[model samples]
Target: MASSSFHAPTLVSILVLLLGNSRAQLTPDFYEDSCPDLLNIVQAQVEIAVQNEKRMGASLLRLFFHDCFVNGCDGSILLDDTPTLIGEKNAAPNANSVRGFEVIDVIKAAVEEACPGVVSCADILAITAKDSVVQLGGPDWEVKLGRRDAMTASQAAANSSIPPPTSNLDQLISKYAAQGLSAQDMVALSGAHTIGQARCTTFRNHIYQETNIDSFFANTRKPNCPGTPGQGDNNLAPLDIQTPTLFDNSYFVNLVAMKGLLHSDQELFNGGSTDAIVQNYSQNPDAFIQDFITAMIKMGDINPLTGSDGEIRTNCRLVN
Candidate 1:
């Protein structure tokens, strides 16, 4: 890791410089003049949300990931369905799965108060994601900002673009690669599961039908998630069996032991190209943290609406 000497701040600064001509010319100091207190405002609201529910940290992070994956790092996922506008909220991958929009709304209101209409909900989400990770004991990074909100969100794109829990190794790689992320980035981002919970509907088949899982791990989860389809499908289970509330490399460790809570997770360590990446992350926390931050910044660059392309929405759920 030649880039090990570079800190997250410096890495982000370089990215800002490199992307100056692209649509994602987002800067770490994007709000330095207009909304100097933007970071603090978002962080404070996120701290409050996470205090109420520790799971909110992971939910916020997942919201950012889902938002970025759909079209870009725009605030499309935060949009509410209107009579004419169909947002991504009801997308198959989102619907009842993606949580923390209410938390984002709270943060957006606070941000609007501090900075008025200068900030974008998309940028609020980016900042909140960093704060959420820090709240959950994960490494922090400088967040790139200056993205605009997408007036139109595609439910179809959300359904097709965001990777599903049942995805296999090849599907995972292809899905991420479609978004310009490398296989390494895919495995690194998957490490976020260290903190969140998955629905029984998402993992029922993995525990009951999968042979690669640990017997003990499967049994522990079985009592909670009924074997029959649609039964107890909404029961909650931690993605990381060991540390469900902490952000750490425990997810990769679980995959190595065949205790991954989802089929998509086990696919990473199932003797594929990503197996070595998973092993490296499990053994090297520093490496994992660095890669996760880098991948996050990279993912934030996807198809962003910058400059005169998109408007700064006063309300995240409704376009101005």
Candidate 2:
């Protein structure tokens, strides 16, 4: 792979020639200053783009799932540090299996056409997710700005950070906690799985052996998720029953129904300590959204580099 090499003087020279700011690094403050309406614009633009794709909701839903599950949506999992083709593919394209980067690429193109280099992909994802929640009729979340991009994506981190569909409540909590999120945040963030789709392979164990899921629902799903090994592609799981495109609390409703597509989801209500909260949210969307917003806010703040920990990235795929 080929990369552009940079030295402080050369970068400064170019910046001085272009924007006349030789001393200032590409900063998150730049986005806030140059594009005051960036978040709203990103939100609207993401909605429009997803509407056109017919898969935006699924994509955004997956992005958030992977983001929170992996490195707490810090954009670290998306970095392609070594630039290896396999690394990029595994870390970038396959992280969430929801095709987030593809949507992001489209959004990036649109943003470039509209605002040039003023917006970062990481920020685009943050704002886009907030709007996606609103699009799905969930609570409105306050997303802070100034998230920098990573130059190198971490495939190792991606593997370790993302949550498998079969993870138990305890495993899920531990992973999210590493990102600075709490158990409640994990439960709420997991609510996002309410609006997407999963392969049968992801939750095969739950159906075939887990004692938690309702036998009736498990039997219903068995024909679709047959035990044949490597037949994972044959099975399908929908995240939301009513409006998969809209982010809401129906996932919890499905959990109570024993219709959760993933074992991890079913585990919450099957026989876990959080079952009551899951049932409560399943029964009340309003309360779910209120808590979901709170959880998302917490998830977004996990391990964030501020006050000198991380640099403000000009490009999301690379570190500044």
Candidate 3:
């Protein structure tokens, strides 16, 4: 019987065959194709969408948060048959769908309609994240493409890896670092919370406990959190400071006043290990933007398959 697996030539062999030098390694362009170019085209469309409706920028940011937070940008959450798929909502029953998936779906559908089976959903995610930051008035970061889809989705892994809305500064730092992001990256990425909303459940612990939380903010949140657990998450928790819907560095400004709603946000200003980085970002908007870009680049580089570990998936939904 014949074997049924498909295998591309090894990188070493390919280099030797193509250039007579096995020592030569692949560059980012080696994997470039219609998929990444098509991603650029879709990014343009998202820009237009954000331009028309500013809320779309927050939606895009939410998408990045949900998609990556769930499964490290594997595109598994986008699957119609995901185990945790929440009807048409695209999130866990009480969670939001991160909104931008639909926008990305539109782009994917257009790509498929124009040229069937060309782009990968993983690439779509990477592109959308980079573009969404730009849409939100952040720096435009460069993304290296060719991320293949994962064969499985992990609700456990998602829950395990993602920093909860109530995470302290140290916890947040460790989690991002596991994904190959730095402490600076953690602060910059946390800036994303500046425009998102969390449910009552996500931050309820911080409010009701009265021990880990500041008294004033806890008192304010008590009515919404009910002083109990498992009671809320559907409640809205916006990430932005000035415009809850718009993207700006006001999140940093909010930090200066101790107005951060999420524990993760407050922890940054809690005089802990990461406070200096937070203060630095808060004091300088330009530095925040610069670090945000660098952090995004670092975040995108996390544990991705390259050279040989994974395949270029035809359908963004599953691994080949």
Candidate 4:
């Protein structure tokens, strides 16, 4: 969907936040009493989606990352453009990309029926990310819950906060650091790339102009990803060349081989501080999986809106 005009935050939104900034701690069983079926409902829907399309697991996981990075995991990424608020779906990094909203909508419907106003869209995203990873043969962690949906979304934040495919090592480290993630956490979390695909537009320059990439790998990618701007822009290329549908340590192995599909993916091991971490993960799948789980849970803790801060949207697409 095309983005509507951007909207600046209203004065009221600023004041309301200043008045109530105390956050409640998120817990693993936040919905045990109110929504006993919440986890099952989300897991079932996510499993179905991934079963239908293996790539969907990556998309759902990407959605959660995109949401959390911009505005701190408040479900602001799920908001739709209205007469007022500007949604993040059409932001620069997300426009024509960052999908799986329809899947999220379906999950929300099932959850609403089972628990009504108890669960939040923000919490749904956390669980969906975990379930999606599990469906794709990745390690699973107990997703902490009780996040509330944002009343407004920042398209500007979405554009700036999310690290682009072209990001370099330093830029990547700084961006992840800004979100309270250590550089080690950044590399571990990046292992999620093992199960995703990138559009040709995202990797065109990396394959053509970059020297760190392997020659044969770059040559293999060139035919599918034309050098000309806008040509074959949306063409698909697997993030992990060996097994794009599986969530494993192969992504780190690709980095070791200098075959990372995106510039940012290669940055993890490009003679930087994160190189050792990447190397270890490439050799030790157990270490990578454990660290990845640690990073996912850490990322989920970023600036959540708990207690009475935000609302539990009945429809994830629209505020009630």
Candidate 5:
């Protein structure tokens, strides 16, 4: 028998070609035969979780976004830190902010029992996000599946890639554009804020120092998010004051009224390129829904590891 091994350069070239060909191989019906009930199982679990705590829906949605934005929806964000890996959970953008990991664990367990290793954690995150939005009264979209779990996580990538609450309009646009998202996508996706709450520390600067915010709204939020550090830092406030638990156009409405809880939220409506897009969404709920669905589907298509490129992890937090 001949022992076979390629030179370093030849191996690198082969890997790159494989990865390049693996992109965009996902489809809506990827699991039709392998795991026919995958969507239903995920939906049922997400529904129960959201019913127990409405905030769980928002947390899941944010988790999906954070996961997708960094390293392209490959379940890298779900990995727990190991001796060699620095997981994204403890990164500056995600530390003490992202939640709903246990819900994902529950769903993963149910999925494994039903179909063993057929489904991918990346697909689970995407589908759970869509189901969560629907359960919370938001629009529904068909999620493209077939993504595979990442073998590693990157804390440095998460810290730099995930947009902060303090981003300006240009910074936000550039950040989204880097992920192949448009300004319209940015505005439409920001509507996810309608259902979630932001921590006091996340929005403290906006409530205390920003001039674009409504004085009354700022004053109201000020008490909950004291100017002093470490006081009320973890206190929660609705991103959309009108309907915090409901997924509606109230987030755009809040933006129109200068009541967006975070500086980045308000930046969309602050006399910038995204202003008209925000106004359109604020007034037309149908338009917002359509655009949001389009944007979400596009977002979910980000750099997925398809074909034989990556594995379907039996445990989302640990690669198999």
Candidate 6:
């Protein structure tokens, strides 16, 4: 009689575990009941930030990409270093490159005021990125929510996982493929450069040494990004000179003209496997917008810690 009771309870427990895992899938209305005004709060804050500085829209979008790529959109990139935890902030690709943390803090404060501890920072990032796209004239898509904040951060993973600005075509394809993204997705996502700017140091080698770039474009950027070390390293240059502040197909157009600011940016159009996709995007704005929206949605689905796996962080910069 004792053994029978134990076996029955164990079977029930197994079933519960399976059901719990199945219910961890993300949905657009995940916070509908808990935080009815969640989307409004995020959109209002993001609009104000982007209105103050047009680049803030691009910064927020980049922040989402950095967070998602490093550790599956679990909000690990936002964590600050502690005695036991090394955060992704100081990673090579992100040390001085990533921005918009202050904007996220502002949005989180508004969310906490309304919903207290109900919303997760991961969801905040996903929504803010979507809002940023809309503010910058890009296509809007429903961002699936329910991701939890990571208790730990990985600087090593951030360094290795995130592709560098100097990546070649093959490297870029393989890097995105490792994250389950296709080459077409990579080309579409690269269109995000339409609004952001890169530091001189990031494109110095590309402008100075790469023969794939247009001579005129390379020479124009060289004065600000000198070949000599420590010279104009922090200078800023728009990634897409034609429409630097607008989210458009100009980035692909520039790539076709060999005017891409970074080596990685040019790699998509450099007679490689991604060349056809880049050509298609350059000639068709609607196609680029559709693929970009689909790619962003796919990227957001990367290895999230859902259900009870992680905690809802009260502060975006610190784990609760």
TM-score against native, each model? 0.93, 0.78, 0.76, 0.93, 0.93, 0.95
Off by over 4 Å in 6: 1-14
Q: What is the C-alpha local distance difference test score of each model?
A: 0.91, 0.65, 0.64, 0.92, 0.92, 0.93
Per-residue lDDT of model 2, residues 85-155, tens digit only? 22433653363365666666666666766676655565667777777766655667567655544444556
Regarding lDDT, does 2 or 6 come out ahead? Answer: 6
lDDT of 6 by residue, 185-247 (tens): 999999999998999999998998889999999999988888987898989999999999999
lDDT winner, 1 or 2 = 1
Between 4 and 6, whose lDDT is larger? 6
| Candidate 5 clash figure, as a count | 0
Predicted candidate 3: what Cα RMSD to the true structure? 6.4
lDDT, residue 236, model 2: 70
How does candidate 6 fare on TM-score? 0.95
* Model 2 worst lDDT window (10 residues): 20-29
Candidate 3: Cα lDDT at 265: 78
What's the lDDT for residue 115 in model 5?
A: 97
Candidate 4 lands at a TM-score of: 0.93
Clashes of 3: 13
Tens-digit lDDT string for candidate 5 (1-320) = 13335476678899988887656578899899999999999999999999999999999999999999998999999999988888999999999999999999999999999999899999999999999999999888788898988999889999999899989999998999999999899888999999989999999998888899999999999888899989999999999999999989999988999999999999999888888988889899999999999999999988888877789998999877
Worst 10 residues of 4 by lDDT: 1-10
lDDT of 1 by residue, 1-320 (tens): 55675677788888877766765578899889999988888888999999999999999999999999988988999999999999999999998899998888888888888888899999888988989999999998998888988889999999999999999999999999999999999999999999989999999999999899999999999999999988898999999989999999999999999999999999999988898999999999889999999999999989888887778998888988
Candidate 5: segments with Cα more than 4 A from true spot: 1-23
Residue 197 displacement (Å), model 1: 0.2
